[model samples]
Target: MYVMTLTKSDFEAFKELIKVTLEEQTETFLATKEDIKHLPTKDEFYSKMDEIMGELKATREEVVMFSDLNRKVNDHDERIEKIENNCVILFLFT
Candidate 1:
């Protein structure tokens, strides 16, 4: 069991409190019109994300190609060194 009493001023104050709370909650859940204009739309965001991903993929492919080329060049350098050493030894003997 509960006993409750409300003066007229108290009731008016409670009403004002409820009104303020509702306004604050509404603002929290919903952005203002100005805020919406500054934000990107969903489609625009996704389009930009897709463009970035494509660029990233292309960059990755280029890195892999350059890495392979570097390895091949290193292998060729080793072979060239071995050939040069063999030539020097043959020349010394002759």
Candidate 2:
């Protein structure tokens, strides 16, 4: 173990040093009242978020509709191909 000693003056100086360092750190880390003055209100934030969610919901609906339409078109194409094949077979037989 090591031993250390501080004179009264040295202790006083150390306390002053800690006080100044704490003040500086507090200023650096803490926000002032003016810093947050321009921030939006809670209602404004919620309103904007609701708008964005609405747009996203609309986009999702459109995508679902497009997917359903594409599936129908594919089904029709498959039916057309089967009809064409049947007609070709009938012609060959005749």
Best by TM-score: 2
Residues 1-94 of candidate 2: C-alpha lDDT, one tens digit per residue: 9988889999999999999999999999998779978988899999999999999999999999999999999999999999999999999999
lDDT of 2 at 35: 90
Model 1: lDDT of residue 87 = 100
lDDT of 1: 0.96
Model 2 score (lDDT): 0.96
Q: In model 2, which residue pairs have backbone atoms overlapping below 3 Å?
A: none
The C-alpha TM-scores of every prediction are: 0.71, 0.78
Quote the positional error of residue 7 for candidate 1 in Å: 9.7
- Residue 52 local lDDT, model 1: 100
Off by over 4 Å in 1: 1-22, 25-29
- Candidate 1 lDDT by residue in tens digits, 1-94: 8988899999999999999999999989997788789878999999999999999999999999999999999999999999999999999999
Estimate every model's Cα lDDT from 0 to 1.
0.96, 0.96
